[model samples]
Target: MNGAGCGSCHSAPGVWPEGEVGPSLDSFAQQTLIAGRLPNRADILADYVRNAPKYVPQSGMPAMPLTEEEARDVAAYLYTLGRR
Candidate 1:
């Protein structure tokens, strides 16, 4: 997701320079809510990863140019953040 600039705004365990533009995704697996509103499930997380604006129109995050599978993959990866 480097090409999508996810690391620029989010920081996992090993990633660095987690930008302040968005919240750090360090403990994503343990998060009870996604974006502070939606349920923290894989499907919801995938949708949020692809089009956060759809869930929250006022969200600062824009729609990501990723396919459904790509978004799902990203969501799955995010879910593994705090697992280790």
Candidate 2:
């Protein structure tokens, strides 16, 4: 998947180049919420990955073209980041 594009808006330990548009994802796995609103879970993350605007209409994230499976895969990968 092209989750690398996400690095342009959110910073993660291995994803580059770091961005300032969104919050850093270095500790995403430890977060209690997604976008500070929805519960931080696989399903929610996958949905957000597919279409963030659906959950947060005002979200700056644009809808992605990834398939459901691809979005879920990206979410799973994101959950591996910043594991203590």
TM-score of each: 0.88, 0.88
Count clashing residue pairs per candidate. Answer: 0, 0
lDDT per residue, candidate 1, 55-84, as tens digits?
Answer: 999987889999999998899889888875
Name the best candidate (by lDDT): 1
Q: Residue by residue across 35-61, what tens digits does model 2's lDDT show?
A: 889999898899898899999999898
lDDT of 1 at 27: 79
Cα lDDT of model 2 overall?
A: 0.83
Candidate 2 is scored at a TM of: 0.88
Worst 10 residues of 2 by lDDT: 1-10
